[model samples]
Target: MNASLPCVLFVDDEERILRSLRMLFRGRCEILTTTSGSEAAEWVRRRPVHVVVSDQRMPGMTGVEVLREVAAQSPATMRILLTGYADMDAVTASVNDGEIWRFIEKPWVARYLVDTVEHAARVAQHDFALAVARLAVPPPPVVGNAPIAARIAVLDNEGSLAAQVRDVLPAAVRVEHAFDLESTLELLADHDVAVVIARLSSTDGDVADALKQLKRLRPATLAIVVSSLRDSRLLIGLINEGQVFRFLLQPAPRELLRRGLAAALERHAHLRAQSDLLQRHAVDAPRQEPIATTTGRLLRAWRRLREAATLRSA
Candidate 1:
C-alpha cells in the first residue's frame, strides 16, 4: 500500500461489491475492504483511516452501528453511508449518531463516488493533523475579554416551541425566536448564534434552504432540524448540503431536546476554537433561487456581504 495515498475503507457483506470498489479506487487510494462491520471498526481504532464507506445492511452489524463505533473511536475520520434501500431509520441513525460527512446512494455514479471520497480524504487529513496538534498543545476554550453568551435561534412560527427550547437551556444561553424567514435572517445577522433549531416544513419559506444558507454564511453555527416531515431525501440533503448536526421529530421529549442542544453548543464551541474545521461544514451555494424575487436577491446580497466579512476576518 502506498503510504502517500489517502486511506479509505469499504465495508460490505458482498464480496463482489468490495472487489468492485477496490478496483475503482485501486490507483487513487489505499483501499481496505471488509465483510464485517466490527472488523472495519476495529481497523479504524487500530490505524488511521481517512474515510470509511459502508453499506447500510449487514448480517450481524449494520453500517450505522459500524460508523457509530468508528465515530467514537476516530472522530477525525470522515464517514460516508452507502445503501440502495431508502431505510429511513438507518439514515436518521447515521445522522444523529455517526455524523456522516455524506450519504451516498448505492449504485452510485463511479465518478461521483470517487470525487466524494477524495474530497473527504483530504478533509480528513486536515482533521487528523488538527487532532494531533490539539493533543500536543490543546487550546483553552474560546473566550474573549468578556463572556459572550452563545445565542440559539429558533425558527418556529408558534411561540410554544421556542418557549420549550428556552426552558430547557440554561438562563445564560439566550434563545431568540423568529417567526419567518425575514425575522430569522435578521436575527442571524445581528447575533453570533451558536445553534439554530428550525422546522423542515416551515410555512414562511423552505426551511432547508434557509438552513443551508445560514450554514454557508456561518459554518460554525450548528443546526438541529425538528420537524414532523419524514422524508429520507430531505434528510440526506440536510446531511450533504447543510451538514446539520442533529434531526429530531416534532414534539420531542424535553430531555432529548436538552441533550441535543447541549451537544450542539459543545460542538459549536469546538468549531469556534478550531476555526479551520469550519470548512468541513461548508454548503453548496444555491444554484438558482426558487423564485427570482426581491427577497431572493436580498438573500444573495446578504450572503455576499457575510462572505466578504468572513474573508476580511480571516
Candidate 2:
C-alpha cells in the first residue's frame, strides 16, 4: 500500500459488507476493514486514517460509540455513519456526539458512495494542508477592530424561528432578521455579518441561489441552512451549490442552534485572520476561491440523478 494514498477505514459486523466496501474502494484508497468496533478503534489509534465509515448497529458497541472514540483518538479523521435504520436517537447521537461528517444510509449507490468518500478524502487533505500552512507562518494581527458585538443575519420568513434563534444566541452577538433574499443581501452589504442562517425552502426566493450570491458577495461569510426537507438530493445541492457551513433541521433545539452559531462565528474569525495574514505577507495576495473538487462534481451528478429518479416515479 502506498503511504501517500489517503487511508479509509470501514467497520461493520457483517463480513460480506466489509468485503463489498473493500472491493468498492480498492485502488482508489488505502482501505482498512475490521468487523469489531474495538479493533477498528485500536487500528485508528495506531495509524493515520483520513476517513472512517462505520455501521450504526453492531453487536456490543454501536457505530456512534465507535465514532465517538475515533473522534477523540483521531480528531482530524473525518467520520461517516452508515446505517440501515434512521432512528432519531441514532441520528441525533451521530450529529451531536459523533460529530460525523456525513450520514449515509445502507444499500447506498456505488457511485454515490465512491463520490462521497472521494470528497471526504479531498476535504481531509485540504484541512491537513491548511493546518500545516498555519503553523509555517506567524500569527497575523486581528483582521479588523470591529464592534464587540458580531452581527448575524437570519434569513427566514417566519418571525418565530428567527426569534428562537435570537433568543439562543449569546449576548455578544447581534441578530438581524431578513424576510427575503433581497433584504438579506441588503442587510449583509450594510453590516459586517459573520453568519447568515437561512431556510432551505423559502417563500421569498430560491434559498440555494441566495446563498450562492451571498458567497460571491462575501466569501468569508458563513452560511447555515435550516430545513425540514429530508431529500438527500436537495441537501447535497446545498452542500455543493451553497457551500453551507452547517445544516440545522427545522425547529432545531436551542442548544444546537447556539452551538452552530458559535462555531460559525469562530470559523468566520479564522477566515478573516488568514486573509489578513496573506495580505500582510504577500504584496499581491490574490482573493481566495473555494476549491473545485471532484466531490463537488459528484454532488452535482447526485442531484441530477435524484431529480431524474423523481421525475420517472412521477
Candidate 3:
C-alpha cells in the first residue's frame, strides 16, 4: 500500500501466476513482478527488495540460482523459494546454500502467502538490525567445564573476575592469561578454547564483529561478557547476533557466576550434542549455535580473530 514500504520481488515466467499473486498481495506489499529470474535479479540489483519470491523452475536461472545470487549481493534481503515441483536435493540446497527463510509451494493459498511474507519480512528486518548492532555488541565468553575434552582455549583477561572464574569453573577450564591484546592471540594458536570470559569495555564496532567471527568459526564455544557498562542495545546485539550466553555486570557476585557457569556448561553440552547430530546427518551448512548458552568465550580470543582477519584482509 505504501510506496515507501519495503519492496518484494516475485519472479515467475508464468504471467497468470504472477497476476494472481499480484492480485492477492497487491495492497499488502510493495510488489514488483517479473517474468524471468534474470529480470528479477536485475530488479534486485537496482532496487532494494526486502524479500524475493522466485519460482524454482525458471527458464534461465532456477529460483535457487536467483536467490543465491541475491544472498551474496544483498544478504539483508529475505529469500524465499517457490515451486510446484519439490525434491530433497533442491530443497536442502536452497536451504543450505541460498539460506531462504521460507519455502512456499505453488497453488499457493492467498492467506498463507501473505502470512509467510509478513513473517519473513519481520525476520529479515530483525535479523539485519541485530547483526548491525552486534558489530558493537560482544558475544558471551564462556562455554562449559567438560572434562571429556581438554581445555583447548581459555578466555580470561588478567583480572579478579578471571581468578574468580578459575576458582568456580571446572579446573579443566584453560587459561590464556592475556592482560592485553597481543598475548591473547598467541594463546589462541596453542590452545582450542571452548569457553571465553571477556572483560567488557566500551569499544568500537570492529571489536564486536571480532567476537561474532569467532563464534562463527567455533559454534561449539561459549562467549561470556562481564561488563561494567550495561548498554541494552549493545547487549541485545551480543545476545542475538554474537551468540553471547550470559550477561554479568562488573564485579559479578560469585554465587551468580557459579550458577551461570553451570547453565553455560549445560548449553555447551547441548550444542555439542546438536552438532554431533548434524554431522551424523552429514549436513554441509554450518548450523548456528543456539543462543541459550551462558556466554561466549573471552575477549582475547575474540579480539585476536579480528586482528588476524584484518591482517589477512589487508
TM-scores, all candidates, are: 0.91, 0.67, 0.44
Task: Sort all candidates by lDDT, best to worst.
Answer: 1, 2, 3
lDDT of 2 at 158: 75
Cα lDDT of model 3 by residue, 179-273, tens digit = 64335445644455556667777644244444555565555666666767646545534533455656677787898777766665665665554
Q: What are the lDDT scores of the predictions, listed in order?
A: 0.83, 0.71, 0.63
For model 2, the superposed segments whose C-alpha errors exceed 4 Å read: 86-93, 129-149, 189-192, 199-205, 208-220, 225-252, 274-314
What's each prediction's clash count? Answer: 0, 0, 32
Q: Residue pairs in steric clash, candidate 2?
A: none
Give the candidate number with the greatest TM-score. 1
| Candidate 2 structure lDDT | 0.71
Error of 1 at 104 (Å): 0.5
Candidate 1 lDDT score at position 289: 49
Highest lDDT scorer: 1
Residue 238 of model 3, lDDT score:
57
Tens digit of lDDT per residue, candidate 1, span 1-314? Answer: 67788899999999999999999998999989999998998899899999999999998898899999999999888899999986778888988888888899988999989988999999999888888888988888655321257889998887888999989987878889988766776677667888999866743356777677667678888999898877888888778878899989888789888888988888888887788887678654554443344476556646654765477468
Better TM-score candidate (2, 3): 2
lDDT of 2 by residue, 9-53 (tens): 999999999999989999999999988999989998998888899
* Residue-level lDDT for 228 in candidate 1: 82
